[model samples]
Target chain A: MSDAKKFMYINRKAPYGTIYAWESLEVVLIGAAFEQDVSVTFMDDGVYQLTKGQDTTGIGMKNFSPTYSALGDFEVTKIYVEKESLEERGLSLDDLQHLVWEDEDEDYAEKDSIRLVSRAELADVLAGQDVLFNF
Target chain B: MKLTIQVNEGPYQHQSADTAYHFAKAALEKGHEIFRIFFYHDGVNNGTRLTTPPQDDRNIVRRWSELAEAHNIDMVLCVAAAQRRGIVDDGEAERNGKDATNIAPGFRISGLGQLVEGGIESDRLIVFGD
Candidate 1:
């Protein structure tokens, strides 16, 4: 019922094997142009999309992992990585690409863009979204 | 609350259509308005009327048609996806020179804009997919 809606893009699939991950990113980039409150959640196999040191040269595909870093420039700063998902995959914050954004309010201080949340916290975030895109 | 549901996969092959249907039914039972149900990707297959499942199996397409008829819900199938998958209404059939149109009752074929509009117009846009 809020005038300004909150949008959440849920990534449940891993990248490259299917088009879902790539298409989801396309939607997020376009959604950013709307200037609405946008957030993205990485859960399930989706956590693999952010794994750092991705080398797609052997896969014959462009390595789009770096696109996550550009999200902050598009004002899509809220990137939630579910704690359980990372743990299940034996990954930590160090395994993922570090995303940061400049906080102009704090005199242009760079701040981390990723928020590590538990399953319960992620559920609350999911419930709070006005629009959800899952791919 | 106004809700818009998106189904991104075909019936039976994936649980997306079933989940979306159940979610829509539950929302309607709670008196929430479903502004639109946009079917995209393989989800457009749910609108085809030519499906003939086993007699004992539930007819997913028919179930959606009946639900839309009962609630006057707007069921929209993405035109691009439908065309690629060969799911079309009479209008699309004629325009594309197709031999037949298979879109089921209470369903309409539309552009991707309908999905975006659904998001803008509804209070909540819930997506169900694989």
Candidate 2:
């Protein structure tokens, strides 16, 4: 197999209101099968995608918020949530879903899938990616 | 260096198509090769030849076609997205029982694999969207 390329999905839209967040997630799931170094960055309103207790019952739409938790199964473990976005929205790490994955190389220890980073730090991450999908 | 450009929004609705065009032109002028320009989501509308913009305005579709012709650039519209947005070529129009095919010149309908392949083949993949 060829060495994996760094693929980053930049999510800047909120879920439910538009199709971007949901469609972006679908691409990440499909792209994971390619075995690339896939990472998802949540910035701007995108940070709301990970907000816990998303109940779509009143919206008459299927709740797809749970899908974010399953991303670890596809080997998409690098989920970055922008600190500035969350703060601006009056949210914190505790308000988001706790995504975890098993590290087989580290004696099967469970590791947090989401990494909270500052805007400057996220800029560095963006610069390091080989491919960036913005939505 | 080889580069791939992805435009996610439609012309007039967003500046993605315009920005991507200038980026591609600048890259070509700098002696860089553009592996492909993949249109996804509403960006597929850019491949439709049916649009007749105002006489005074710049024709985005024509500009893209002319650029593709000038540089031999591969301009591909995502088949799935195009189908959803009613953008069709001769093959798709015939297959789907449509009367006319409106795909602009120099643009071809293709699968998402082309986007992935472009990412693999190109040194950089820049996405322009809303």
lDDT of 2 by residue, A1-135 (tens): 568899898999999997778867867877777878999999999999988999999989878899999998899899999999999999999999999988889997999999999999999999998788888
The docking category that best describes candidate 1 is acceptable
Top candidate (TM-score): 2
Give lDDT tens digits, candidate 2, residues B41-116.
7899999998999999989999999999999999999887899889999899989999988999999998777887
Candidate 1 regions exceeding 4 Å error are: A53-66, A100-111, A118-135, B22-31, B54-57, B78-105, B108-120, B123-126
Candidate 2 global lDDT: 0.90
Q: How many clashes does each candidate structure show, in the order listed?
A: 0, 0
Error of 2 at B4 (Å): 0.8
DockQ of each: 0.28, 0.42
Tell me which residue pairs clash in candidate 2. none
The global C-alpha lDDT for each of the candidates, from Candidate 1 onward, is 0.89, 0.90
lDDT of 1 at A6: 82
What are the per-residue Cα lDDT tens digits for candidate 1 across B54-115? 99999999999999999999999987778878997889988989998889999999876677
